[model samples]
Target: MPRVSFAPPSLCLTFLPLLERLLPSLPPTVRDVDVPPLFREQFILSGYRPVDLSWRCYVLSLFQIHNETLSVWSHLLAAVYVLVRFLMFAVQQGGGILGVGLQGPEGQGFSVDVSSLPLVLYVFSAVTYLSCSAAVHLLHSEQTHHSLFFLEHVGVAVYQYGCALALCLYSSDTGWTQSMLGQIFLPVVAVVVWLSCIICCYADLHFHRPYLWHRRICQVVPMGVAYLLVISPVTHRLASHNWTNTSTLPLHFLQVALFLLSAVFFSCPVPECFSPGRYDIIGHSRQLFHILLSICTLVQQEALFEDFLWRRQALVREFGEERLLLACASFLGLTLCCVMTALVMKRRTHVQLLQEGR
Candidate 1:
């Protein structure tokens, strides 16, 4: 056998350039003026990845420095972290694949409960929305931007339904639950959430750059309605309950505050608007929105988990098995409706793009 020659570290470093040359390179990022108006974020003056690149290029672009890089990684990491934390919590609680168990009153042994179902659904929705948001950032292309936008809206609708479901079941006080509005809250929320998704998609399709305010109003109004409906229970609980008695109340307040602050960033470009080109690579309003929303989700999850554990028995007794099942089923149906709505909107978007091309 011929003597084998081992390259020293310095000599190995010399081949790094050649190795890099053999691999595919990321597409060059473009300035706002270089891309179509549809892809240009307001006040984000640079670091846009070129449009019409291959899917592989878009995926590879995740590692490259660009405006959407943080948006993609923030939610992607959040989804993974949320999922892992949930699974760890489930395992620690001695839960099965479907639900978690807690020790019963009077020294009764731990038992698997359907009361955990809403919480489970909430976690599922959180993961889904985070993943969808990440995909909207990562896989965005000129051809499919409308579809991704619709998908993100659907994800938001699903998440809103999840929060409403959990709050309705676990967080609402008995007085609130028995109230007229609470009786019909979930049903109304389902309608409003679906409408919100539709309105957002329609706004995206109909309004271009010049009609920015019109589009924002269309998108924000339905969402505001849905949010108010969903948050009503939390508001009631906060108002009625004794402040010093509950540990989770602070988390509820924190989540609400964080979400409201995030909405500001979502609606307006801040530091970027003031110093356009400087924030292109980082610290933009959208990135801040993503970060704040992720934290809000975590805070909300923690508060809900506490409520679920403390009130699980009361909730089960009050709502009964049939009502709980119905509530979960309604949410599932809402999710299906939102998805169908997105698909329809996506098809319309594709047709419009084709017509525009023609």
Candidate 2:
């Protein structure tokens, strides 16, 4: 056999670079330490991680290797799905994607009602929440994350109000907001409830170290209470509502249960905590929370749509969809104002750390 001589190292180096260019490439993966402190959870070992690289690199990182890849995609895709569905619904009625002023009972031969506009805003709020979640986890900017958390909780609170209004619309013989006063206490109580949630969520970020455990507990308490309070009233009257049968409660309960489960996963990072880095990539508590929350949103959406379709006759007979839309517009405005107000700015510790090049 003829002896084979290896190429010179320098010559080999030249060919290696060219060969690398010719071959299929993969985005680089990262270690946890290179990621944000928020992601430095216990046991998070070998998943894809985000680094504070350049802006272009950060955008490219979406498809690149990272632990939060699934989280970013799931929520982003969910927002897309909601937007698409809303657009489809709006297209048929000749309304814009926002679907403003386009309302009727759900079903074929869609009729128009001006009063039903507020439901459109509520849908917008839900979409806002999902979209913000995707943005926050994907970008992971300290300022944006903190601000987005405020936005996220506010979105959640607004969606809950929408949920209450939908349920109230179903339960009563009047339009959505008109009947909101006596039966649906959520609209009245929600201002306090959501504002409290926003504050706690803000504190969770703004106040770091010292009583870290205490801060976490404080976050959980508000969320836990909000979940309990919001779900109970919205779901309790589902079956007995004028538009729904006794049998519907089971399905409605499923929606509420999913929301509750999502809350549990959100508040208690159980299995992930137990296993640590084992579930850093997928099946993490946060990912689970995202999935459950999306499912709950869909479940409630379908039910409310159906409830509106059947219940529209009653509402149209009384106040009309236009009136309902107009009245709830104020409520939507209040929610937006409160959320914007709660989005308080604070000095970002993580950004400061990164600035020192640590």
Which has the greatest TM-score? 1
In model 2, the Cα lDDT at residue 175 comes to 33
How well is each residue in 9-81 modelled by candidate 1, as lDDT tens digits?
A: 8877998898766555886888988998888888888998888888878888888999998989988888988
Q: Which stretches of candidate 1 lie over 4 Å from their true place?
A: 1-23, 100-112
- Runs with alpha carbons beyond 4 Å of true place in candidate 2: 1-27, 48-50, 89-112, 171-187, 209-211, 238-248, 316-326, 346-358
lDDT of 2: 0.63
Clashes of each: 0, 11
Alpha carbon lDDT of each predicted model: 0.87, 0.63
TM-score of model number 2: 0.74
TM-score of each: 0.90, 0.74
RMSD of each: 4.4, 7.3
Compared with the true structure, what per-residue lDDT tens digits does model 2 show for residues 1-358? 9988786789888898887655424446656667666656555666654444444455556786566777777777777776677666666645632433434455435444544554576577678778877776766654455666666666666666666565655543333244444444555556656666566666756565433767776677776666655555454465337434444455577887897788788777767788878787788888888888887777766665555556655675665656576557756675866565554432443564478684
lDDT of 2 at 11: 80
